[model samples]
Target: MGANPRGCLRACSLAVRSCLRSFIDEAGVPPAFIVGLSGGADSLALALTVIDVASRAGIEVVTLTVDHGLRTGSAHEARRVADLAASLGARALVETVRVDGRGGPEASARDARLAALRFLALREGAPVLLGHTMDDQAETVLLRLARGSGPSSLRAIAPIRRDEDGVTWLRPLLGLRRADTAGACAQAALTPVEDPTNAIDGPWRAADGSALRRSAVRHSVIPALASALGVDPVPALARTAALCAADDDALSEWASGLLAVSCEASPAAGEGSLALVVSEVSGAPRAVRARALREVASRAGIRLLSGVHVDALDDLIVAWRGQGPIPLPGGRATRVGRGTQARILFEARSPEPTRDGG
Candidate 1:
């Protein structure tokens, strides 16, 4: 921590300005942008820094605080965040969303929050900024590592990403640590809201009553690992994620080129169906082939393909042995034809009807 609070604040401001400058250089500055402010230390610091940077650039900043309505006092907190943003010379709004408990509370809340943010961004025709720090990236890599995730999953969070809906999400704090944000907030005299869900011993838990995976990782696993190693593991893990991201980008580009040559629309199969020429795909290395397979499935509207699904799909290419159609979540894959004429078809499944007639 810097001895002078103003110096710490200035350092954070410079870091944020650098990130914004990079985006401006690539995409040009938008007339305005939306920042997701949760009133937490990370977001509070980001909002303050962004407000300062944008003010100097004459760019409008709108801070949006989403109230997930999962816990008591959330609405009040949202309002408080908005008030702080207004005081900082930026427009602020509170978006209230209902979490339907799909996929689990954590996942569901995230989906809801993002949905709201995307909606507002689309309406305003602006990009969305978020406050995800290096510590968060470390936790994500650690969690995915325990699950035996692939390169894509282990890449963790990208510093900037454009959603399929044409909304660009920017994370300016990815290079900064969690402690940096907290210190910055203190320097600026901002009192951030403490989220109970982030507590390891908080009420939020899995169905089995264990602590939430991220909270446990943040409070227990990282500390224990640091103690055992006699060094802080966050920067090293975050560096690993950055390296994985670069490798994944290269692999993705290669896979995309292969897909362009091998994949085509299959009108005979069904609407929005895709056909992959087996001869063209089978020649590629398995790593590239797996990526191409996943891309084909994703284009066919299957978003959640596990490693098992990709392996089974790969079988349709190199391990073909007269296997039948493999059923997937939203579609099915089948091998057709023979030799040079062989093609793998992905088609959407028709929805099953309810027992009661419409």
Candidate 2:
């Protein structure tokens, strides 16, 4: 709609075009692609660029604005975003989700939003595009690091992820900074909705009056680090995430291969039961072994397997001293043999019988 300053709009358009072209080359062109628009600068810029790119390719763009219903006037904000999308010649939908607050408010809202996006993407057989920027990536890595996360956890916010249910999630803007998106929005003569919760000292706060974790990182920690080092820390932190992602990918591949060779499902033990060759697993490095064990536990129908559970399982392999059955989330792991024939058995615990028979 207007001239781009410093080519921010052009850069975003090029990035979207490249990502769409790559996906098309792999799976052929779809009728449409879905965009998660929140009326924010980042999503607005993404919507503009994607609309431009899809127009050229004769593809339709559908934007979904989710209202989490966490605050007042959320429905109005959703309508505003949908109106903008409709004005730009794209189909718009507003999804209202209830945040159960199972996790913290922030996390629960995200989960609800993602679930809505995934449902729409599946129904339309399209890819879902998000507006996560390099700044978001840096914040994610910093937050995970503060939690003492390992390499796999540190490889945060993948640019492209394909879920098990065949939903493709794409974040083409991860290479661009937050400022670039804001500039792009300005270039397009679009005024973005400023959500107060994103502000450093906004209305959202913890019980102790501290800002939200991400907001605090974005406004305070990142700037403080930059001031201390006399350099922008975002690029370096983003680079670290990229490096960790590469390493994690390699290790994951290796772990898969190791599992294929050293693990087997026991038919006699029924479903959700597997056995791992203790010697083969113990011979591998700790990093690869840890991943393999996690995979094994997942296959055994164990959900939410924590580090403590994994470590205890690992000890059964390396630090074995005739320990008893180690209980897991949904099952138990026990060593069944000794010497070279040792096998770690992961079996789902049988459901207990009801007191009153049906």
Candidate 3:
């Protein structure tokens, strides 16, 4: 806690050991091998720490570095990470991939990186590990808050997520900070690369600055609130997020039972190409209705959704006077006409019947 890199490294090692052991025991994920490596401090530290932990547990470790090919020195940096990982006692591999940075540069790089990791995991038959830290989550929440997002968005990111491709992605360092990750990497004698893009000011710069701001909010703002308002805002907000997640989970389960899955975006939709049917989304509770509509929109491949969009869908459910249809953010809605069976058929811009080809 004192900004000591060695201490942070030790703590990170302990955390990695605990998470890997627990995941093996509970999630049935094999411990013999884990995949993830980059020249970045967070990932390098994670790879080194995982090797130390897994070796003690009689498990083998492998490191995979995905060169996004976005920068000039990316491939060379990947090789350095591989060499360092090998010295750390992991069987290291590197794969360079072409990425266009489409659909927003950061997101596209993330997609390409994750796709490479998933491929590596499947090929190696192992779970892939990531180095997203708690600081990252806090920053994400702060960014979402600035964008006027909802509770789930404010919850930031999940520690674990599984893809339909059977890839289990784990973030064992969610409770650690970026500064701590750097400290750990230094203690491990691993020199991490500083991606110039990370420090550069651009549209994505706020994404990084948000974390610094969030730390201030957590360490400074919340305590100020506690002193002035006689309450800790951090704990209160965290508890609210937990409650919202619980309610959201329940709503999702209920909606799953009530609504039928018509189509899901395979490659996923980015713009207004997504759509869901009213037949499957109607007659549910407001919570369930919101979730169903969002899922449809998501299946249509939209990533960022606004609260207003959900509210508009809610209004459609209740105050819908069948006057054609209202305009949605990602797409337009049309009532089309009365159905043969007296049901109102609602369709979005792309129409409904497109299936996800995953």
How close is every model to the real structure, measured as TM-score? Answer: 0.92, 0.95, 0.70
Q: Which regions of candidate 1 deviate over 4 angstroms?
A: 1-6, 351-358
- Is candidate 1 or 3 superior in lDDT? 1
By how many angstroms RMSD does model 2 differ from the true structure? 2.0
Error of 2 at 163 (Å): 1.2
**What lDDT tens digits, residue by residue, belong to model 2 across residues 1-358?**
4334247888888778788998899989987989999999999999988988888789999999999987899999899889999999789999999999776677788899999999999999999999999999999999999999987989999999999999999999999999889999988889999988889777767657788899999999999999999999999999999999999999999999999889998777777699999988898999999999999888888767899998999999999999999998878998988888899999988776788852
Instruction: Give a tens-digit lDDT track for model 1, residues 31-112.
Output: 7878999999999999999888888789999999999999988899899899999999888999999999988899999999
Judged by whole-model lDDT over C-alpha atoms, candidate 3 comes out at: 0.67
Which 10 consecutive residues of model 2 have the lowest summed lDDT?
1-10
Error of 1 at 242 (Å): 0.8
Please give the TM-score that candidate 2 achieves against the real structure. Answer: 0.95
Clashing pairs in 2: none
What is the number of backbone collisions in each predicted candidate, taken in the order shown? 0, 0, 4
lDDT preference between candidates 2 and 3, better one:
2
Error of 2 at 113 (Å): 1.1
lDDT of 3 by residue, 148-178 (tens): 8654566667677688898788888887777
